[model samples]
Target: MATLDHILRPLPLLFIIFVISSLHVLPASATSSDKLKTATTIRKVNRKGPYVGLVTVIETEEDAFLASVEFRPDPNHPFIDLSGRRFRIGKIHGKKVMYVRCGRGMVNAAAATQQMIDVFDVKGIVHFGIAGNINNSMSIGDVSIPNQITNAGLWDWLNPDKAEGSDNEAYLDIGNYNVPQSDGNNNMLGSLRYGHEQLYSVNGHISSPQNVFWINTTQEWLHLAADLEKMELLQCVNASLCLPEKPKLVVGLKAATANIFVDNAVYRDFLYDTFEVSSSDMESSAVAMTCVSNGYPVIVIRGLSDLAGAQTGTNAIRKFGSLAAANTARAVLEFIKKLPSNYNVNS
Candidate 1:
């Protein structure tokens, strides 16, 4: 003899209990005396800002060709469209994503990266693509994520005269030398923050440092040795100052390092045996440094495409480049999806 409202009120709770009981639900016995709640609650999803930008630099049609193959149109994202220049710019995976075709070299890469941050108002940026392997232990398909960066050519000694002189040579020195915002002695205090890490270093090579290396095992390569090599590192780092709130940045995922060019491998054995590098390519160091200086989380993923040693006649670069680029792209997309809501300064 309960009222209809009272009967329905209990019905919902009763049904829930019935369903749980029928399903043989029971909490795991973690300890001897722990009590279990009647129902397990689902945690709410804390969605963050969608990753808004991804940048890649290609020197040739072939380089861009690799990117095009991996970038498929998202069915749910009908608004996504490539600009006339072939850069993908639109909603991707429900985020207002923009892909800019940053041209090759340090300068081009810098310009493109700056525009994406400035015009698009992107909250985050991922600069991806290929790199040449510089470590002998690394194979053609192995990837490199360099946490350090060194501008091999940027460490020569500064003449004291130039600092105090008044000639055009003095002015030229002043114009060219950007005394990195570092404590003169590699002090960690003035270092830039990236994630939980601190990044501090300047460009230029007045003298060769001990560990740096180029294609050849020489003092010069060692002096200018950098974590990665792209044309845009300094420019991108400098540009961050202009943003209202600088975007979080990272570099590289699918790349290889080669002591020699992909087209030639005459000294493959020597390169594999002596030269510390394994694969070969064009960009990455520039991008890596930019991310580090600007306080962004970075992950470098890459795929190996060739063996620089005796097994040299393989067209693995083409076959493996595509696979690596695709795999790298997928990984990057997954990372973007799970970004925490409070990832940047603004958040």
Candidate 2:
């Protein structure tokens, strides 16, 4: 309720306020977004970083590294918290590294990856965790290192198929508030929907929508990981429970990501036949996208913890998740050991 004269009576105070505002003490909103991108490739990121980042989606996933790898926490800077994630800086397997748990879901995964690249000297990223199996041929406890990852969460739930028998790639005909009956299968049974997250990098500062379906991983890392196909994986979850056969490593398959936990057999089969993906997880695609945008090398190692929605009887994820994570950890360790000391994490 002060008049202009009264408000301006404190001339020195107003001058100080003006000075502080003029100095721009508060950071601009774009400051953080500006940091979203850096080098676009491992070669550009530099050879100086001893760290090859290890990213996980959950605590159990991080346990995979904790069980097998010897992590020497960074002596000077042991940990960093950014975007609600604590990045543990360390050296594993005698190689410099920073490990961080990205938590679950696509947003957390993407944020963690961006923070890891922007906040540290991250040369490459190796994301490992457990996932639902899409390929029935592959059993629980086996690991899959796919060549590509994609986000299937982007969607357009269309107006119901008003014109019946429309040749849509996916159309669940549920008309007029109808509760479509399940054909003993958890089919989509609803309106048609589209998916595939959009983003094609025109450059570091710009990404345009391209409607692309896949995010390819670093070819160099994928070829190197190919050797792991022969490595043995953990088969037994203790004495009583064991996988039917020795868990195997299968490489070069495609994997997918979505916020949704896929557990419907009908949708699972649809994903399998449509996308040709071998595994589905909640995080990998976001990590892959972030890495790709930053021009860094990235690969995801996933343990098959459940058969997506196709598992018979009870879902085994709760029982075998740790086992799968451990196998993936072993695979990551082997991959690290195989890297030449001179590789410099792609410096």
Candidate 3:
């Protein structure tokens, strides 16, 4: 037999050389295959369009149903399903429209809106659904067209004693504090970024620099809402469920968006008094922000389904959610019909 070192040294060197060659060959080949597969998948699923987008929150399936009913889907051009999210192309009022149901809450709304813009070439967005009424003057089934939407929970929570100013304006003082940033997730607070900016103005007046992230609807869209406001809204969902008051469209009001489902009278009062918002919802402001970022116009039409915490008994959402959704759908369809055939979102 050969001496141990002499026999094993050449074999070990050869083994190392073989392993290095395999690593280079295998990984390079695998990476190339992966790239090819990715390219093929993108080619298969990518959609091209000059389409208008409509978004509805999942909590209000009635809204999505009503919107889908207005559109006549083309069998030859079926909706492209990306993963589980479906994007349907259809004709509404003779206009090419894409309908998607964005799940409830701020993050879901933002992600869905951006997807429509990036993947579907969505020119503009119209979001419809139900909201909780903060204004006592409004009733169930009434529609609110918000000119401005602010994130309600984007704030620095401070002790009442630490806050400066009168009790009515005490929240403004907390704006000075550099609180850890959060993405509305309780556990992930302070992980992503830091500090807050003055992103909201109460009725166009900026009182505090923290606690609000406001996004204004485009003027063109608001003008369209003004015209739609003139149209009569549906007052009943069915024979068994008629609104106590005739549903009316109220435009130019403010709305608040948050992840919380607010059913407390005290919080409702705080939001209404602080923001002068007529309605509160879980999605609209985030949708507004996405549209704004894309340089696209967006309008939010919310039908009141509850009094938000004013009632002591069962929530009105159970009773009037369908009616509110129908009214919102009606308003959105009417708005689409009124759009000029040559309306260019770019202009």
Q: Point to the candidate with the largest TM-score.
A: 2
Ranking by TM-score: 2, 3, 1
Tens digits of lDDT, candidate 1, 1-347:
53324323433354344434434543463321221111111000012223355666553322433344334433333222111234454443344455665666655554555444433334656666654444445544334433333332222234433233322111112222235633233432221111111234233333432233221111221222232222121111133322122111223222323222544344444333332334444444444444433334334333344453335466555544544454345445544444443433222
Residue 237, candidate 2: Cα error in Å is 1.8
How accurate locally is residue 275 in candidate 3, as Cα lDDT from 0 to 100?
A: 70
lDDT tens digits by residue: candidate 2, 1-347? 54434433333353334333433543565242222221112212223365888889888878767776466676656665444577776666667777889888999888888867754566789998999999988989999999988787765565433343433234433342234645322433446554555665535445455556688888888888999999988888899988788999998999989999998887888788877899999999999988887788999899999988786788888999889999988888888767668644421
Off by over 4 Å in 1: 1-51, 59-87, 91-96, 150-280, 291-299, 308-310, 342-347
Report the lDDT of model 2 for residue 306: 90
lDDT of 3 at 3: 39
Local accuracy by lDDT, each model? 0.38, 0.74, 0.70
Provide TM-scores for the models: 0.43, 0.77, 0.73
TM-score of 2: 0.77
List the candidate 2 regions with Cα displacement exceeding 4 Å. Answer: 1-50, 162-189, 200-209, 343-347
Deviation (Å) of 233 in candidate 1: 29
Residue-by-residue lDDT tens digits, candidate 3, 1-347: 43334322433354334333444565453553443343333233333346678898874654445555677774555475533577776667776777888888998898888777755556799888899999998888899998898877565544443423332222533222234733323432222111222443333444543433567897877786687767887777778878777888988999988888989876788778767889999999888877876578898989898889888898888888877887888888888887777643321
**How much is 110 displaced in model 1, in angstroms?**
2.0
Candidate 3 segments whose C-alpha is farther than 4 A from its true place = 1-48, 62-64, 67-69, 159-212, 343-347
